[model samples]
Target: MVSDRRYCRWPRSSRERTCISSIGPLLQPSSDALEKQFDSWQLRITPVDYLLGVADLTGELMRMCINSVGNGDIDTPFEVSQFLRQVYDGFSFIGNTGPYEVSKKLYTLKQSLAKVENACYALKVRGSEIPKHMLADVFSVKTEMIDQEDGIS
Candidate 1:
């Protein structure tokens, strides 16, 4: 097992430190493969399936963010944002053919992720704690919007 003390070593030179800092967080395990799978699945799945898959993936992404925080890895937030954006872009490729309910839910999900991304950006810039309430609000809004849009009223 990788020890918690095992950190990626940055170069000693000041110039190298500047370059490393500018490059941002190093990618973690399986991120590239996951993105590729997400892309391939998005292309093949039906609208309903796509929405469901995205929702599932979103949940996983959130968990990853939390884990990152717990592990003192701030870079995960940026990765989450990038993953979310890719998910959104994948959905966009499906156009207007999705069920109205799914479409609306997806939109709400996107909005919630926008909030997360903004929060992460703020955290990255100012180094703050991301509010638990914000994450809760996103999930609640997503559930409410999905139900309402799906005529579950």
Candidate 2:
């Protein structure tokens, strides 16, 4: 068996995580593809790093949902919400047993999912009442109010 110390050389720093998160969307590779690429380049990454990068992606997806809504795309928010729910469900299976970095990202992931869900809820319930052009603004204000109430900001 490989010793745990062999894995210790992989940096757990936030800078490394930020780099990993940025690269993921550009290449958009599957996990297997990423593993193969890393092997070819003689680089190492832990499972926890992969999970953290995925968690960071939820925040980007949340932004995409809001931007798509602003651009008058009514379908993207629901689609993103569904995707985020699946990711959240997957993370839920990991529970509190993950590394501290992985566990910490779960809250951010949940927050991203919540924002998408809120946008979706608004679109569904008030689509008829609100003008299409103003929908994004309404969603932003509603999200901000929720953040304030939740003591997040």
Best by lDDT: 2
Where model 2 places Cα greater than 4 Å from the true spot, the runs are 1-43
List, in order, the clash count of every candidate structure.
0, 0
TM-score of each: 0.46, 0.71
Best by the TM-score measure: 2
Candidate 2 lDDT tens digits, 75-147: 8788778778999999998878988877788888888888899898888999889888998899889779868
- Scored against the true structure, residue 11 in model 1 reaches a CA lDDT of 35
How far residue 116's Cα lies from its native spot in candidate 2, in Å, is 0.7
Where model 1 places Cα greater than 4 Å from the true spot, the runs are 1-47, 128-153
